[model samples]
Structure formats: C-alpha cells, structure tokens
Target: MPAKQRSFAQTLNAVAWSFIGLRRRRDFDEDVGALNPFYVIAGGVLGCALFIALLLGAVRLAVA
Candidate 1:
C-alpha cells in the first residue's frame, strides 16, 4: 500500500516526539511511512531553533 501523507501539524508532532526520544514502537513504525522528508527536516530545524531559544530565555531569566 502507498504511504499516507501527513499534515504539517502531524509532521511537527512527530519531530517533537523524536527530539525527546519518546515514541511508542507501534507509532514509530506507522510514522516511518507517513512522515514527509521535507516536513521532517523543516520541523527538526524549527524544533531545534525553538529549543535553543527557550534555553537562552531560561538562562537570561535566571541571570536577571
């Protein structure tokens, strides 16, 4: 069967779960076929940026 395409939000959700290393085995299996490469890469980069920004914000808050 052909893989089903995912929406942007679904892509980001998958990326977020991946970043934290918290996906269920079954879900990961399903996502393996469903996630778009372009969306995955974009979401990964965006997630990384947001994570860095949050860390910086927290550090600034602590310092201030």
Candidate 2:
C-alpha cells in the first residue's frame, strides 16, 4: 500500500514532538510514512530558530 500524505499541521506536530523527544514508537512509524521531507526540514529549521530566539529573549530579559 502507498503511504498517505500528511497535512502541514501534522508535519509540524511531528517535528515538534521530535524536538521534545517525546514521540511514541507507533506514532513515529506512522509519521515516517506520512510526512513530507520538505515540510519536515522546513518545520525543524523554523522550530529551532524560534527556540533560539526565545532563549535569547529570556536571557536578555534576565540581564536587563
């Protein structure tokens, strides 16, 4: 059977779970088959950038 395509939101959810290291094996397997590579990479990069920005903002606030 062919893998089903996932929506952008679904891909983002998978990327978020990956970042937090909290995905279940079954869900991971499902996501692996459903997610798009482009969305995964874009979402991961965006998520990382957002995380870094939040950390920097927090540090700046603490120092000020």
| Highest TM-score scorer | 2
**Model-by-model lDDT, in order?**
0.93, 0.93
Which pairs of residues clash in candidate 1, taking residues 3 or more apart in a chain or in different chains? none
TM-score of each: 0.91, 0.94
Residues 8-61 of candidate 2: C-alpha lDDT, one tens digit per residue:
898999999889999999999877878999999999999999999999999999
TM-score of 1: 0.91
Off by over 4 Å in 2: none
In model 2, the clashing pairs are none
lDDT of 1 at 10: 97
Task: Pick out the ten consecutive residues of candidate 1 with the lowest summed lDDT.
Answer: 23-32
Give candidate 1's error at residue 59 in angstroms: 0.9
lDDT of 1 by residue, 1-64 (tens): 9779899999999889889999889988998989899999999999999999999999999999
